[model samples]
Target: MAAGIQQQNAAEDIVIAGAGLAGLAVALGLHRKGVRSVVLESSPERRTSGFAFFTWTNAFRALDALGVGDKMRGRHLQLQGLRVMASSTGEIAREMDLRVNGKLGPHEVRCVQRNVLLQALEEELPPGTVRYSSKIVSIDDQDGAKILHLADDSTLRAKVLIGCDGINSVVAKWLGLAKPSESGRTATRGYARYPEGHGFEPKILQFVGEGFRAGLVPWSDTDVYWFFTWSPAPSPDANGKEDRSAAAMNQFVLTKMRGAKVGPEVLEAVERSEMSDVLAAPLRFRSPLSLLFASISKGNVCVAGDALHPTTPDLAQGACTALEDGVVLARCLGAGAERGFGHEEGEDRPCLGDAIVGAGDGEERERVVAALRRYAGMRRWRSAQVIAASYAVGFVQESDHTVVSFVRDKLLSGVLAKTLLMMPDYDCGKL
Candidate 1:
């Protein structure tokens, strides 16, 4: 950890941690409102490991607010509905139309490559906005500002800090939040590429089996993203190295689905994936109740995205909700600035030059804190509901008990799928 020695310069208006989806989106949102923020990323460069994200209309609305919706929409494939099937027999269970409500114009569920989205967000920002390789080691809430200690032996002070780091966020730990709990399931995801183009319709194909679930979504004519989730089998050595070679993992996944009802196209997609691209990890989520009641921000230090509301991907709302957080948080801060809330005496915070007049230091700090609290208040219940729903969906889908499986297969699947499809679209107002 770097020492907490303060630098000679003045504090920044806002400093965001983790330049992933949430962090970069917030920065871009703030920029659109004429509020400047510094984004710090721990990684040496943009992440390429994440294969793809299933983005819905709500996420697209948030992106549109940040002014990158059309560009992002053009880079992916759109789907009208999902094909649910029985994993054991591979029989078509149901087809749930995604646009049943028709509330989001013509927008439908789409799958975007994660790196492509990140790059689009990065490109929208001014050059040099994101500082890579700048990992934070420690944070101290001093007086009315946050002092950050980076692993590179440097320090920075900001009036407000937003932690958009993922599940293992150092900033969340500093906020006294418990570590994320594993969901007792593991996920393996990869992208299947075809230079010759895959002749597949725009739809998501999902299969549910005992203690396992699998899905495939065509990202474009040439690329498709696939995922499998299953309860892990006990191993004598928990930390033992397993073969991660593409051929080995592909074989492992194929063997698991060998007698299942999956189609030949699904098998072919997995076989086409590069071994290095097939990544697996244990799924984890933060308790929604804890997230609802916990203090996400103390003074000017706060957290967002997975750092604030990590949940299972059963509902495919994790990324969508994170995008919502960025838009809402930026709007709150921008509203505060409009109300003369972020100014201070003799302090030069970017993007608030004209709004700094006539506010005392004490008054400014009070309003800034108020803005952060409002951000938390607005997000708390919304995030809790999504987290809880996602967890419940996962529980029912993954249960192998005879009674639970019967309820899921016969009753819950139809009702729950429709209810999920009818989930109201969210708009974060405007910046």
Candidate 2:
């Protein structure tokens, strides 16, 4: 450390990769904890084209803790219940009343465009805190400091590295965690505007048939978010993107259900959707660690969000869990600094502008690891339960066998439908 050279400031050195919901929520949470974080997004600019996201009461409480819930006003379309229809008859088979479920708290879950929420989070961060177009190449936790190697050949070191970089996270792979498992089916998502001549009440509607299923989640009077998942799937298109050919996918589904009973309106809506509006993806998830990592901080590194738990959207718990991670991590840091846990042994901690600083090789390493393990331990089981339930939901919806489908449609739907409505405390957002 020489005179006139700027030193690192731990308060300003927390770098979060990927500016998706998980990354931004963590930044917002860190701000509330009096910890400054610099968010690094690889995208050239902010995105506004994301589809709809639903927020349960528990997630709302978590957002409230980050101080941004007020912006959600007028964005929520309260769900009254979930509706399941018979694939062969198009008759309502079951409904889960949400009114009774409201007893846990305000049951009015909010739905908003994902981009709007991202903007809200961006606005809450300190000006100039996020750096866009700065992509990460490699992260090396060696010689004490956790060093981030950028594609541009620059470097960043910090007391800890929280990997919110998402499913393909380079950081998690560097830590030797196994890659996420690809669920055999492909999932396509899109929004359909309520064009003229259309009339349907707001509801959470799902239709199931052999080899495929579709879900319609209403977000407002103007739009409906829908997705379809199918098995024995086609390979990814040339660009490796999900099969976004809406006309093709929908046509495949319509053929599979031809002469099968379903509402004409639902069928019409699917047929009319054009190719340009759909987004597609192959679903994936990490193998659950029987024990939360003994240390997320291996030496000077840590991971969060998708890097740690890439959940299936079947649960719709992805963003909620990430938001919780952001807040909890920030809470630990802000709280840790107060207990004098920010510095490495022997050497002073690195400041923002200095060469990377390490969290030390022995006692300091154990302490940081212990903190992260605690954080992971607190979060892992809850996440595992949600993932399990989500898989079961998918199984019930995608079953094709006549006997199994009949039993599921007639007997299981009634019970499972109601359970989803009342599963309180599912979102650990309060932390």
Candidate 3:
């Protein structure tokens, strides 16, 4: 009762599945636009455990549009830039500064905590905005509304439905989008603490070794976030596969770091990690080209966030893009969250389409459909580019081939630095 998180009592007008980063942010953004939405989380409560991420300028613009920029800006430190190092020699491979004053003015890059970002957006909503323990098992479209059949045997009719549910999303499945394919690479991410202070400068430190790549970002005075990504050697037998257990994963990272000859101080974070803190998983992403003609929306039901496009974390843009999805989705919906509202004749911006009410069935459906289509169209190209670019970057960085390494370390070092700088220049536009 004290917090805005609440249980749903009946059918909701606008229903968003998955109360993670995208669902919550989209719901909140919609709230700012005077559109009400209910977020359904499959968990029993607000799940907050997550590693930190590099929030680039595009993410900050999305946060500002969502009206929660200051809350996060106060919590994390701004990183000046990052240094990519060659693991064997501990020599800098590429050093890129993030202080570019380009397209969207000066840049803003911070290694922000995922839990804090989620909680900040949640606090800005009214009670009952999010319905935890709510899972949509199946969905279907009737006359105009999408009927969401919950796991608890109840149902909610949504005038407009957005599937922010992640990778294995039921809504996305219902829309018949292809399942995300797993890349050959895997990643382990966790945090390290140095109470007296890590004594590291305000920037990211990365290490590249053969098929393994790792990086560390110090976000606070006491805590540092780190991640290691590698392509596991293909095993002929199932028993030869890498262990998926947390303890095993922690040991694997330490062993790999030692074998790579990474500096003692640099590998200290993994060695100091609690077995529980070290988490690992195989990277997965959608085939970017499939999205070109994907069925993202059918009538009033559409997808966003991971449900829309789950990109690899190589670009450090998974959550950042999710934040962007929220702002763009809400902005496009523009008061069209309510049914029977159509834009007035020739109105450029939305908001229930010029307050047209008592419109015919087609008119009402067109307004909602149009809004969803606009959002899907606007985000499709951006998501595809992210998915494609992330995989390409990961492939290049983690390639252990002799020729590839020579090309990367010799020919493309400057290009790597430039690409990093240019990635965040994208502006997600205003609400």
Candidate 4:
């Protein structure tokens, strides 16, 4: 190989695609491990469009490991419990207490704003770690290096490539993984602000009706995050595109729940949502069974977060699992480098970058490949379980059948609540 070629590849040791929560968290974790990595983001700036998500105990554990747990926890109120209500009767159908931690200790759950979360992760990264507007149009595996073709007509060569892009990931497709299928549902999410102070207890308040579901979580004293999901997903508009007009989606939420027996606060929350705060999407997930044979990783390239396992939001574990993915992937890669390559510093552990200098070597390449395989091996089953459970929970809770509703609302509500609480009781291990 030419000296210039080797130098170019040396400067690109580890490169991660997409700067979302998963991508940024991976970068942050690698930094903590003393491994440097560059993140590529297609957007012109940091994307803050995901709105917010419920941060369960498992997510907080990963956040703590990423060094932002205290910062995030300090910003949002810990939700006390979950309130399930019948949208028709305006009466609380069930109350699931979340105060007890079981084995995880003082149960921790909070509704975290996506913008703030992204900001926190970015702050932890070294300056210029993320290259925005640097989109990867295509990828090719050449020899031991991954050749990334960017949209700007530039190219990058990396010893290791981690794809943390979202559901419709280019990286996932290149790896020959099956495309995600729709869940026959659509969700509209938004936040409402009350400068004067919105008075609501710190509880995840949810309402359900035939073929529809909605929920609200107080984000802070002056803000609340809410969402509406419905079955028989909406059709594309004249342009043959999912209509994302904030006005349309906002009005749709109000019209769908006009006659429902939900509280006035619920109605007002949706009504107060500004166009800027609203976001809409058709729900989609990669079948868990397909994951059984999915190419989560190939050679030194791998996928993480939604790129690897796009699960339904029924369990509210989407973000949490992504957080878990970041830590696990970092640990696997960092450890693999140390174990496979001898550190030159006598007894001290070498940085992943330093360990993989001659990454083109057969033995060095094998080390990176093994690291990715370990990541896939560790996360594949765990992710499949979470995906399947989310689907099952959604199937039962959203079922319109009279008998199923009876079983869900009465016979097994408590059991379901306990089960849901226990779903996120995982530890991502120390970073």
Winner by TM-score: 4
187-269 in candidate 1: lDDT tens per residue?
Answer: 78898889998988889998886677888899899999999887764242356965555666677778777767778888888
For residues 248-292, what per-residue lDDT tens digits would candidate 4 score against the true structure? 898878877886777778889999999988888888899898898
Please list the C-alpha lDDT of all candidates, in the order they appear: 0.79, 0.65, 0.80, 0.83
Q: In candidate 4, which residue ranges exceed 4 Å CA deviation?
A: 1-11, 235-243, 340-360
Name the candidate that leads on lDDT: 4
- Per-residue lDDT tens digits for candidate 2, residues 326-372, read 77776666554444444322335432332334423354445555656
Candidate 1, residue 419: how far the Cα is off, in Å: 3.7
RMSD of 3: 4.2
Winner on TM-score (1 vs 2): 1
Expressed as tens digits, the lDDT of each residue in 231-274 for candidate 3 is 86423337776577777777778888888757676678877777
Better of 1 and 3 by lDDT: 3
Model 2: residue 378 alpha-carbon error in angstroms: 0.8
Determine which window of 10 residues in candidate 2 has minimal summed lDDT: 1-10
Tell me how many residue pairs clash in candidate 4: 0
Q: List the residue pairs that clash in candidate 3.
A: 342-353, 343-353
Look at candidate 1 and tell me the lDDT of residue 367: 66
Q: Clash totals for all models, in order?
A: 2, 6, 2, 0
